[model samples]
Target: MTQSYKIVIPVFFIGFLAGAGFWYLFSPALFDRVVSEELPAGFDLSELRSGEFRDVDGAHRGSGKAQVLVSPAGAALLRFTDFEVTNGPDLEVWLVKDPDPQKSADVSASQWLSLGPLRGNKGDQTYVIPEGTNPSEWGSAVIWCEQFGVLFSVATLSEAKI
Candidate 1:
């Protein structure tokens, strides 16, 4: 083997490995995770407010329902049903004060609380709203990409009778 071939072969392999890792982290790969969140046992969940998700842009579209649920005792939960969003490196669930958030700036400009990292990009999942946090005060439930500062989806919550 030539001296140049030895160096070229190793360099090529290293580049391939690096590219694979980047793709795995940053690519728009689709994955689904369904979670059936159980409450404290005896109580039933009632929808307080709910909204249908709207895509922020073509690349970061989402479609589903985001429901803010509460129990009889005032325990609150945020749930996403029939949910799917564009997968990203780091996505978070945020309750923002904006009634209608169309851009990423709306999230940062308004009063907001982060529920936490989104459990899954596609599927049914639940996030526990922090104790004493009033879900009613927040108007939008957003799927935000923290790493890139992008808004994937926003749902403008409306009061529900049931």
Candidate 2:
């Protein structure tokens, strides 16, 4: 091979590796989420407490609706409906006891329950608060990026006047 060709080959390989590394570090998880999970057959949706999500920190950017539903059997479920937020890495759904947390530092000091990694960046989803965990104690629903300690968004919980 010519000297010029040899140098070009090595440079191309290095460029490829660097591109892959950056993609892995910053690209959001690609999830094609459709079809809402079915609530138990006897679950009642008539009585639900709802809230509206707000942006927290520059990292958390999205608007959505949150709902706390009690089934006829007394099981509590948290559902996010009409939700859309910016994609993030290692995101989680958290029910926070703090009424207002503006940044990562504020979130680090607060008590929270992990509902699990977020299902998707957009659309409707549901999470079952483990048996015996009181949703009432939490004042907001938070989209948290666990890997980067970023709070993506927060929704203040309030009883819907029926």
lDDT of each: 0.87, 0.80
Query: Which ten residues in a row are the worst by lDDT in model 2?
Result: 29-38
Candidate 1, residues 58-100, lDDT tens digits: the string is 8888999999989988999998888888788788999999999
Using TM-score, give the best candidate's number: 1
> How many angstroms is residue 120 displaced in model 2 relative to the true structure, after the best TM-score fit?
1.3
lDDT of 1 at 87: 80
Query: What tens-digit string does per-residue lDDT give for candidate 2 at 44-112?
Result: 664356788887656558788888887756688888888887777788999888877777777789998
**Which candidate's lDDT is highest?**
1
Clashes of 1: 0
Instruction: Give the Å error, residue 61, model 1.
Output: 1.2
The alpha-carbon RMSD values of the candidates against the true structure, listed in the order shown, are: 2.6, 2.8
